[model samples]
Target: MRCVVLPGVYPPQEDTLLLAAALRRERLPPAARVLDVGTGSGALAVAAARHGAAEVTAVDVCGRAVLTARLNGLLAGCRIRTVRGDLLCPVAGERFDLVVANPPYVPTPPAPRPSRGIARTSDGGEDGRTVLDRLCAEVPAALRPSGVLLLVHSALCGVRPTLALLAAAGLRAEVADRALVPLGPETRSRAGWLLRRGLLAPGQEKEELVVIRAERV
Candidate 1:
């Protein structure tokens, strides 16, 4: 899908495509409602809509991303409801049959100043779980019974913890898809920091991106 990502809005990347591919393989319920958290360019939202979602709602914390997603949805001939809010806050108390997310998962050093602009797209705190942990805790609440969530993140963020958190939330979670890709610019820039933190081995040039499928049953 061709999406117009405005300046500062995150463009769809490997993780987004990985999650989208998982979404395509999922058996969505009839007239399923879908939610795309951290919608960014709305690529996943558009994908969900095209994949037969009856209604698609996309949420993003960045205003630019919201606009970019909304515009992309229109361009793609998909009706995506884009909202600007943190994580699932915009859709509180709403349940969806499917949810997808490709949040910031790159491990970044602790800076005196918080990440801003496009940096926010991949700034996953010191351990890279800051946002991922929050998503694991919050997504279950937004899912309907039998609902499925497809989330993509780097292994550096600790997949086990994500599974544990989802399990603790009463969801059945498993690694659904994975790919070994060269480190993205964001991750590459932090290779030294990741190595120091033991998240990356010396000279490890590739990062494994994992797509986790969690079902609320």
Candidate 2:
């Protein structure tokens, strides 16, 4: 699907495609509701709508991203509710049958949280679990019974920890899919730092991206 990404919004990348492919494999129930957290370009949101979701909500902290998602959804002839807020905040008290996220998971050197622009798309903090951890903690509460959460992140971010966290949250979690993708610009830019931190090996140009599926049974 074509998306009109705004200047500062994050365009669809390999991670986005991975998560969307996983979403397509899901057996969404009739009248299923789906939530796309960090819907930068609304790619996943559009995918969900086209996948037969009864209602799709796309959320992002960036205003431009939210606008981009709305426009893309309209262009795709999909009815999507777009909201600008931190992950899952705007949908507080709401529940969905499926929640999809391709949040920031690139490990960055210690620095203040990004408040704007494209940096927000890949600034996953030092250990790269910043947003992933929060998603594990909060997504379960946002899911209806039998709901599923499909999240994609780099292996450098500690896949086991994500599974453990989701398990501790009372969800059945497992690695649903994985791919070795060449490091993107953001990851390549921090390759040296990642190697120093042992998150990357010497001359490692490819990173493993995993799609984790957690179901609230």
> Stretches of candidate 2 above 4 Å error?
none
- Lowest summed lDDT over 10 consecutive residues: which window, candidate 1? 111-120
Colliding residue pairs in candidate 2: none
lDDT of 2 by residue, 37-150 (tens): 999999999999999999999999999999999999999999999999999889999999999999999999998987898887999999999999999999999999999999
Q: How many backbone clashes does candidate 2 have?
A: 0
Candidate 1 residue-wise lDDT, 1-217, digit = tens:
7879898888988888889899999988898999999999999999999999999999999999999999999999999898999898889999999999998888889985354588889998888898999999999988999999899999998999999999999999999999999889888888888898899999898999999999997
Full-model lDDT, candidate 1: 0.91
Which candidate number has the best TM-score?
A: 2
Q: Native-vs-model 2 lDDT?
A: 0.95
User: For candidate 2, what is the TM-score?
Assistant: 0.99
